[model samples]
Target chain A: MPSISLTLNGRSVSGEVETKTLLVDYIRENQKLTGTHVGCDTSQCGSCVVHVDGKSVKSCTMLAVQVDGSEVTTIEGLATGEELHPMQEAFRQNHGLQCGFCTPGMVMSAVDLVAGNPDISETEIREGLEGNICRCTGYHNIVKSVQAGAKAMGG
Target chain B: MQNFDYHKPNSVDEAVANMQASDDGKFLAGGMTMLPTMKQGLAAPEDLIDLHGIDGIAGVAEGADAIEIGAMTSHSVVASSALIQSDLPALAALAESIGDRQVRARGTLGGSISNNDPAADYPAALVALGATVKTNTREIPAEDFFVEMFETALAEDEIVTSVSFPLVEKAAYAKFPNPASRYAMVGVFVAKNADGVRVAVTGAGPSVFRASAMESALDGDFSSSALDGVAVSADDLNSDIHASPEYRAHLVGVMAKRAVDACG
Candidate 1:
């Protein structure tokens, strides 16, 4: 086992993991943050997307040992104890999710996209969200949600 | 995924040593391809030598007439570098079109070239630019590097260090991506080098290859219209679920023309 220390959401966390353990596995299993789903073991699916050092990455594709000192933000970290994140609120208001299987990753990816480039256009949003896959909602409401979320965040 | 002893080497020597330590060991670059393959049970190595920690393999070198890029340099880094954008905008654009942002962040040029995936975008750029792939042991010309699908001339223990591309007057890359996988269904790279012109085609073939006929036409007249009659032979191209060999052949001409137009 290799011991690693890194910032999780806004808090610094440390743990020991098997060298082969993926970042998604570590986050979902060891840390007990089950919000980030694992729809596909392959990297092709973006259902396991998360933020690594401010950039969105598919946690499933990366080994936890590879991100020894990087900052990670998952779906579980988005909301305050009582208040939903603006993106989350936008998703709720717009009915962005149906099955909700791919929502956590979509929300996380959308939040990162908005944070990275606040003044994002609809075309850019579609292109940016290309990494993420949503089997439900047909992406119309999700796009509206992200657009509204960006506006709500003063982006 | 098969269990393998993992070693993260901090330096190139350590990486080389780790690779030489076991016959069944494979150097892990971006893990974009390798990890997925391991997970699918397609490849199971006895040892995995992680190469991301080696600083010497992750930088860009600028020269008066060319650029030498470390193999481990991420696609995102290549896409955003001011030097690359100004000097080789086509290459930068090609880098940007690969996979998605997440894959670009972790995938490296060396990893992509070494893997020699037939549908990869970088090989078309490299072959079109006539780049030189430098490994830890020796340098191999791009023409001699790609042997076949998922195959290269690189020895088992030898690791790619960098690739050098001679600055060209104009160049561009164009590709039709498979909607499902986002891998190139067909990609064409057009370049105007000191040696007149070279056109490389990828995704449509068993391996990335130069389209001499297209290069000849463009060499005769460096314009999209010059390729009006040029035909890419369907003989050696790939016919997969995404595209028929005939369709890929047609795409070769269309993409090459698009690249030529963009080059201007």
Candidate 2:
């Protein structure tokens, strides 16, 4: 087993994990951060997305050991005590999610997208969300939510 | 995925040593393809050598007449790089069209060519651009690097260091991607250089191959009209549920023309 240490959500965390332990599994099973859903074990579904060193990546496709010494931010870390992150607040205000299965990943991916290009266009947003699959087919609202979130984040 | 010992080597030599010492070992780049294959039980290596820890192998540089991109450089980096965008926008556009944003954030140029997925887009660009694939041992021309589907000329202990793409007068790539996977159903890359025109097609065949007939036609006129009645033979094209061989053959002509037009 490899002893891995990483800054999770803002705190230093360490664990002894098998080489095959996926980052998603390490977060969900070991660290009890269940907010990051596992909609598709494969990389197709971006439901397992998390921020690794400020970049969005599919946690399920990466090994826990691979992220050792990196900064990981899950959905649970998005909120500030009582206040929701602007993206989460926008999702709440715009009704971006249905059944809430893909919301976390969608929100995380959208945040990164808007952060990279604050002036993103509608077509760019649609293309940017290609990696995430919303089973409920509620992309229209999701796009609106991201637009609102982007504006709220001063994009 | 099966349990395998992981080794993170700081240098190329150390990574190769780790691979040579293990009975069965695999070098992991971005894990975009290798990890999924392992998860599906399609591949199981006894030892996994992670190449991410190695420094000085993951950036882009520019020379007088060409661009040198490190093997570990991610697609996103290449796609967004100002240097590549200014000097080689066609390659940058091709990189941006790969997979999606998240995959582009992780998938590396080296890994994509090394895997040589029949439907991958990079092989077409490499072949058409006349790129040189640099390795730990020697430099392999793009034409020789790709042997067949999912196979390359890379030796067991060799590791790709970087790739050098020569600047051309004009170049463009166009692809009809499979809707679901974004892998090219039929992709074409056309380039016009000092020597002449080179056209490479992927996803329609078992491996990336040059379209000599279309190249010759374009070399004469360097316009899409030159390929007016030209056609690619369907004899060696791949036939799958997504497209029939004849359909892919048709796409080869269509995409080649599109690429040529986009080159302007």
Candidate 3:
């Protein structure tokens, strides 16, 4: 077993895991952070998206041991107790989710996107969100949510 | 997934030494391709030696006569690099169009070349630019490195350290991507080297191959019309869900023409 330690959702967590244990599994099982969804076992669907050391990564595509000493922020970490993060609030206000399976990853990816690029347009939003897929809502609300979130974030 | 002992070496020497320590160990660069394959139970290795923590393996070096990029440099790094953009804009474009932004950030040059996926873009650019792939043990010319699909001439335990591409007069890469997967259906990279014109095609065959007919035609006359009568035999081409061998052959000509135009 490989002993891995890292900051998850602003808290430091360490555990011994199998060499092939995925970051998603560690987050869901060990850390008990089930907010991060795993839609496709393959990396095609970005439902397992999370920020690794401030960059968006598909958690399903990475091993838990690979993130040792790195910072990981998931959707559950985005909110402050009961108050939602600005992006989450914007998504709620804009009705950005449908079935909500992809909402956690979508919101996490969107927050990173908006933070990196503030004055992003709709086309840029679409391209940035290409890695993230939303089956419901036709992506209209999601795009609007990102735009609104960017505005809320002064982006 | 097979059980494997994982080692993240902090230095290049450690990585190379670890690789040489065992024959069952595989050097894991960016796991963009390897991890997925492992999850699908396609590959079952006893050990995985990660190369990410090795310093200096993820940078772009602008040399006097050529640009040397470290093996672990990601596609996003290459695509956004001002040096790559100015030196070879088409390479940047091709890099940007690979997989998507997520895969671009994770996939590395070394991983792509090591995997030698027939549809990968880096091999086409490497071959067309007459690049040299430098490993820990030796340097192999791009033309000789790629042998077949998912295969390379690299010996066991040989780790690619860097790739150096000569500054060309002009170079361009054009690819027809599968909409769903974003892997190239047919990718053509054309470059005007000091010697003459070089054309390399990927995604259409079992390995990246030079388009001799197109190269010969363009050497005489560098024009899209020069490729009109030239035909690539479909015998060795790849037929996948996205494109038939014949369609890929057609895309080879079209993308080659587009690359030539872009290079001009």
Candidate 4:
């Protein structure tokens, strides 16, 4: 086992993991942060999305050792106390999800989308979120939520 | 993915040493393709040599008439790079259109070209733009770098350092992306310069290839309509569930036209 330390959410934590252990597994199993869901074993789905070094990445596609000293922010870190992030609030207000299995990844990905650009169009949002797949809601509400969230983020 | 020892080498020499030491060592850049392939049990290397730790392997250097991009540079970086967007907008657009936002954030230019997937987008751009593939040992022209499906001219122990793309007067890339995977069903990259016109077709064949007919036609008339009479035969093209070789050959003509029209 190799010991690795990284900044998770806003704090620093360290753990031991095998060479092949994925970052999502390390986050969920060792660190007990289960909000980051793994919907697809393949890299096509965005269910395992997370922010590494302040940029969105598929957590399942990255190994724990690959991001040893980097900063990783999971869906669990999106809130301050009880208040939801603007993007999360927008998702809730716009009904961006149905069963909510894909919401965490969707919201995390949306937050990055909004943060990366000040002005985003509906088409860009659709193209931007292509990595994230939601079986339900048809993405109409998700697109609406992203537009509203971008506004909420002061984009 | 099976258990594999990992080494983060600080230099290209160290990485090569690590590669030579292992039974079957893989140089890992972004892990966008390699990780999933491993998880699916398609490949199982005994060792993984992570190259991200190495410095000087992840930046862009601009010359008078060319841009040298390090292998570790990610697609997102290349897509949004001021140098690339300004100097090579076609390359930037191609990078921007790869996979998706998340995949772009992690996928590297070197990995994409090295893997040489049949439907991948970079090979077409590199081949059409007449780029140079610089490895640890020697520099290879983009045309010779890609050998066959999921294979390149790179040796097992060699590592790609950077690729130098000579600036062109005009170039553009257009693709008919698969609705599901976004990998190109038929992608075309067209470039024109003082020398002549070069057209590379990807996703329509076993590997990226030059459309000599289209290039000659465009060399004569520098217009999309110039390619009206030229046609690519479906005979040697790839046929899969997503698209037939006939359709892919048709797309080759259509995408080449769009690419030529978009060229500046």
Off by over 4 Å in 2: none
Error of 3 at A134 (Å): 1.9
Error of 4 at B103 (Å): 0.8
Docking quality (DockQ) of candidate 4: 0.90
* Ten-residue stretch with the least lDDT total in model 1 chain A: A111-120
Task: Report lDDT per candidate.
Answer: 0.89, 0.93, 0.89, 0.92
How displaced is residue B130 in candidate 1, in Å?
1.1
TM-score on alpha carbons, each prediction: 0.96, 0.99, 0.95, 0.99
Q: Between prediction 3 and prediction 4, which has the larger lDDT?
A: 4
lDDT tens readout by residue for model 2, B31-82: 8999988888899999999999999888889977999999999999999999
Instruction: Please name the candidate that would achieve the greatest DockQ relative to the true structure.
Output: 4
Instruction: Judge candidate 2 against the unseen true structure and give its global Cα lDDT, from 0 to 1.
Output: 0.93
DockQ of each: 0.66, 0.82, 0.73, 0.90
Candidate 4 lDDT score at position B63: 78
Each candidate: RMSD: 1.5, 0.9, 1.7, 0.9
Q: How much is B152 displaced in model 3, in angstroms?
A: 0.7
Give the lowest summed-lDDT range of ten residues in model 2 chain B: B55-64
Q: Which stretches of candidate 4 lie over 4 Å from their true place?
A: none
Candidate 2 docking band: high
